[model samples]
Target: MSSAAKRKLYLLKLSPEGNASLLGILQHPDGTVLKQLQPPPRGPREQEFYNKVYDSDCCDRILLELREYLPKYFGVWSPPTAPNDTYLKLEDVTRKFNKPCIMDVKIGQKSYDPYASAEKIQQQVSKYPLMEEIGFLVLGMRVYHVSSDSYETQNQHYGRSLTKETVKDGISKFFHSGYCLRKDVVAASIQKVEKILEWFEGQTQLNFYASSLLFVYEGSCQATTMRLSDVTLAEKRRVPKGLLSGGDVLEYNNNIHVINSTENGKIEASVGKGLSKFYALHKKSCSKRHHSQLSLKVENSEQDNVWKSSTCITQEHLNGNVLPQLEKVFYHMPAEPKESAKVEVRMIDFAHVFPSNTKDEGYIYGLKNLITVLQNILDN
Candidate 1:
């Protein structure tokens, strides 16, 4: 059956938070959503990028490899009544979550594409002067507060108010369940971003400008908890003196774990209800052992703050790896427990992609900063 005949006949109320389109995005019952094709250059540019990446016959290695990091794309859909209205059908990444917390972050130091005019560059720089240093910007986010049984939406204006110091805190708020914080999700998300970073490090075919990363995770506080009478940190590394008790270091098993930031007093009370743990390992020097592996150790890239392979390791990178394996094995990853707090991060908005000869240093710089911010959040 045609996708239009499936379930996207009506307007969608739950489109993403920071949509800049004249019409909202649409969702079909077939586990896909529709984004209306904008006019002229922008629409054609996005479609071109998607088609090249999605094309099966096109043997371009980078585009083919990038397919996994993006939403699965179907062909364009045009309503019979409104023939001019075209929409791109894409995988609905949040469909599986009961209450998904979503955030959109735009990456890179430059928002304008290579084809952009001087005036456009001036406008973008004036809007956010720190983009060159930060390399990323938070556009919008929606978080589900389990305590209130409601979701609060924050728009781009709130994102614009953030400073470099407060950006981590703002990002931290997305994981706050009101009752506890979800660092497990943070760790998993970092791994995924690292994978994307690894891809950017080796590729020279295209440069992604103004591209954004979309993050979605289950926000319902009814976190899968089967009263674990006992829990322990992996490898039994002793945490600092007072960090675990009340300093927000949670050291439970790796499945969907959260922490009480203010007090551990309720821990005894909450244990019966089931409480999981979260631990972020930070090593000040390279002499540390028994550390987790992070893929930020690309040999070819010029990234600093390197974090893997006889160097800066944390707890575990989960399914992350530093070496580039065979294509088939690289994409096939071990699965986490179904009950574990799940997170989905995919690259979106490819309208500004440009063919280049070398690695995207701007994007890589932004990603490194992003991972550092998340690391700080995890450690603190």
Candidate 2:
């Protein structure tokens, strides 16, 4: 049996303090997550993005550079026992963190796609009117609090209530563990995102709407200071997949339960850089909750971006450093390097993307504003 097949599955469980957006996401001990394709245009659209990027023959310069900001893709998968239930077997972006403080912020002034009806547009606008002004909305968040030995979380409701003046504070809270405000981590995140902005500035291939930047950093201070090594990164993660599966996750709930998965835990074996989480939160309790999966808006149109048919990566990288003075700014290393990533800012949710001949200004505007907000936090 393939090692992936021999492995058991577990629900990717998040702490009650933190909310996850997707439903039916399963994780394995080997640092992979499986997201079931949802119905219709959304499923097809997202699958389409991954397919093109991972297309063995694909060499699009924009995509090649953009792939660095995305999670690794391993192609569509369906368990041998459940062929009818196909899934996108992807890398879990949060796998490396000992205590992952995750945030999903929907970017862009317009959340609705070009195809949105007036009613649909109004519904999105009504939820967060400031989306146009702020260019981003905090959809979900979970931050690890070190001193208290717990996690703190803020959901979409909290995101919508922030005023323009306090938006910086709202963002500051994410970088602040109860113990300290991590300016270093904030700085690193900014640097990473700056790279993404550079790509958007040059590309006219895709317009991203109703998408999110999934930010994650190691919340455990001890882990951050340890000088990460292959040996240290190999240390397991937090909780298993629900339905209860295998993983590096050693603890879950207030109570502690450790399961040392004997499965192949090597990071190298996992395909592509891990993907941002793909889940539509469904609370099955008395409250009975259902939400769109991080607002990756779906489109019914059959049009495809003409940019997909472009050239592949040459040895020198992305048509030879489009901005060399910016410091080899265009080179995209192969995804999933041997050294584990300590912090991440992944651009996720492609269902609402449109073909564009000019830059993705809306997404870029939000990114610039976000950088300013984060920078202020770091300064103060």
Candidate 3:
């Protein structure tokens, strides 16, 4: 993560004060965070997850301790008159790590709909060949939007091609300020994810249909860890296999774009001179565009040009200083250092997760593929 002062703090929780769903950070005058969630209008997904899945009789009997693998669930919140307006509040896992860089990956295929109409399923299936040709698809990236800004601004910035953006928008903000996952942390995260999958095997009465894993990474050195979140998409199947009509198969979508990997590569390749060089390049490009747009008398959108065009470290220090210092720090480091990366991989986003009366092959196959991808990343 960049220096605390320069980092654009990302807040994903919705405040109890606001009726509308919001995705931005909220802080006290002294800088203390007040993270909370506001439920969606139509979905009882998260509520169902906590009531039926996490707190179920089946989970109590077979599942291991939840805290070891998951974040602490605080309980549900509801408004006075509106039964529909209910929110699920859980521990803000990002706060557990210093300078967290969070990433949310929606598991399964984009076109996948287990309950979709037959025609829709066929259409989605037909597109699989073309989708396979594309390496991995990133469904979404957690981004920082100003409090007064609408979702469109953030979405527009994120939707833009990564390499094409030059402004201090969402992508730039994340790369410039977010935590970068080091190799050790990545390995730890993979191992923890596998362990959780193994735990899933024990709950034969429950079939976990997960759609996403929100990975939260923290730390600057080899001493780091990743926290998983957002289990609203997971659920227990109606019945276990064998006695069931068909088994469940975990669908694997090869299109994955992890923020750590993407940003790390950019930093190593283009910003080796450190963040200052990248900032310099970005500022130069932005200034030129801004000046040209100024003469047109067009509306100067705040979202486009509002970010501070600066970095924590100077170019001289970044180029002539940092790496050698890090090398010296790790000179006598063990393969897995004593206080090495500590990753907490908890499966999240259980909204789409439900009981499947099918074989478990789909779910297992998808999970193994994900593990393989993580392993390959470490190997490379």
Candidate 4:
């Protein structure tokens, strides 16, 4: 038997709330199961199942009893939490290292049979929460194998329609965060199966927000695929349109071209002479045209510090000139310079104003000691 035939197969069963049950099937080189070990389950279960199985008072107790079975594949169990709680913590770990995480779900019919109505199975799996969380991010395929006993007797009787429905159901469930056996040939080796499962796990670790942001920047506008960055740059350079000498005209071919204020004595005519002409040309070129103008005047005042103020801009308005202007205004704000540094130091009150006070002095001295120790380590 070839080395590839000796790989392990995996079955990942995920509860509705995102807890996992992993079943690893070690396969012999001849495509036979060598051993099958159910992964220790994690997270809260139905009260009845918990009471009957572990006789534990709480979920944590059950987890403790099952601790020996964990850390066998994944290093530690990090249960799912709300986004804000998980983000910074996960960021801390991922900033220094990369790890693979796979996600899977189980699918079984009321008859305890692998083959079932595809549409029905899909509808059930679609309701799972984990499917909703990562649905847009992945595509899944189904693999099917029958129990040894059933495979021999039912092989000839199993119609192609059943196989097709099984495969379809499996894919639908897999897409909806559920897994089921399909008619597609299962990986001959258990190790190959485990590898596929691990691939999905790694995808789950990917930050969804970050990925979406990247997609927005990379995706095209309109039916035609054009680069977002290019569109933004073009918009930034667009010249405003206006009437020139009693006729509408376009002053610039693209936004990058600078309008000469005195090229044709055009500025003296109206509020937006050359710019209005540019807008007219733009309207003619694009399928849809809407024009609005905004003007702002700021008067210098010590009380009204525009430089330090924050402004709200919707994601749609974040491109073009607005983004660059905001960046320029905030360019000098104080920031931490080091990437590896943790714990930003800030005074609780006016420490500088009352430096000699006991509380202020104590804080200052404590900070000084902490910094000194950190500095010493770096120096050594």
lDDT of each: 0.61, 0.61, 0.36, 0.21
Top model by TM-score, which number?
A: 2
lDDT of 2 by residue, 117-232 (tens): 99999999999999999999887676665443455656677788888999998888888655346666787888888888899999998999888898988676532211123332
Candidate 1: pairs in clash: 250-278, 292-314
**Per-residue lDDT of model 3, residues 94-159, tens digit only:** 544433444543344343546656886677556443222222223333321111111111221232
Worst 10 residues of 1 by lDDT: 273-282
Better of 3 and 4 by TM-score: 3
When 1 and 3 are scored with lDDT, the better candidate is 1
Q: Which 10 consecutive positions of candidate 3 have the poorest summed lDDT?
A: 289-298
Model 4 global lDDT (CA atoms, 0 to 1)? 0.21
TM-score of each: 0.66, 0.66, 0.50, 0.15
| Residue-wise C-alpha lDDT for candidate 4, range 1-380, written one tens digit per residue | 22221222222222333332222222222233212211222112121222322434445542343222111121112113321111000011111111101112121112111233687557544443232222211211111111100000011012112232243232232211011121111111122223322332333211111010000000000111112243432244332211001222212211111112344433111222322343232223223223222222222234464333222222222333444332221112112223211111111101011112122222222223322322333233
- lDDT of candidate 2 at residue 350, scale 0 to 100: 72
